[model samples]
Target: MYTALLHQYQLVMSSREAVFNYLDTLKPEDLLKPVASFNNESIGSLMIHSADTYTSWLVNFARQESRPFYTADNYKDLASIRATFEQINLIVNDFLNHFKDVLDAPLTLPKKEGMELTLSPMQLFTHVITHEFHHKGQIMNMSRQLGYTPVDTDVIRF
Candidate 1:
């Protein structure tokens, strides 16, 4: 299951690279342009939010690590954003390795005082990936609103 999941994740990453490649062609200011309908979220901010979600779930919550979340200011351009994703890739790899055998084992996560959430590693992984795709759509829509046609970033490219 872990091996299959890893392969699927690889495909997702490949599609993600396509999105990043398109973003590479964008100007830093374009990436930072706030969309009024998106609650003032720029493409760069959405990207950083996705990365922060992965780190928050896999590294901080799952592994009990104190990985700090990244702000939008930390990734002003595509180069910097990609660099942060490189770190996210490493963190994801470490997480998969650590939980390879126990992907389904229930984990008790704390949420506020006197509150707890029971989830599994696979659940967390699914959540983060889906969350990324959700924001990826938003980014593409934002780019279109900013006068750029969006390239298809789906996993199954036609």
Candidate 2:
């Protein structure tokens, strides 16, 4: 189970890096262009939000804290989005390297009503990666809809 999970993690990381690279190929104006999504979220906003959620989960896992997910506000620019992505990527890589040792660690997370619930480290890590992938798919869809050719991110393709 551990080895399989590790492989999955590596696959996810690779896909993430590929997506980021493809995104980087876009011009600054292209990134800022609005998608037709109902949320009015631009490409940059979606990327920043994805990074924010992943980093928040990682930090919560590391600290064993009971906190709700982090939300970014006033991050309406490319610079802020890039900064958040770098920060999250750094923490994610660090966590992955030490994840085995941290597996047995206890963690707590807050509910919508402010109640705390505990989780094992493995559970936390699972949530972090899975959640990021879910949002990444959304970003990919938006990319396609916006007429930017989406990169092939399937595990088999990688």
Which candidate leads in lDDT? 1
Q: Highest TM-score, which number?
A: 1
lDDT per residue (tens digit) for residues 1-158 in model 2: 45666688778778877776777776666666777672878777777766666656666546644445434542455566656666666776666666666676676666458787777767877787788778778878887887778888755674
lDDT by residue for model 1 (1-158), tens: 88988897898799899999888877769999889999998899999999999999999899888989997656788888988989889988888989999999999978678899888999999999999999999999999999899998999877
- Worst ten in a row by lDDT for model 2: 66-75
TM-score for each model: 0.96, 0.71
Cα deviation of 102, candidate 2, in Å:
4.6
How does each model score on lDDT? 0.90, 0.69
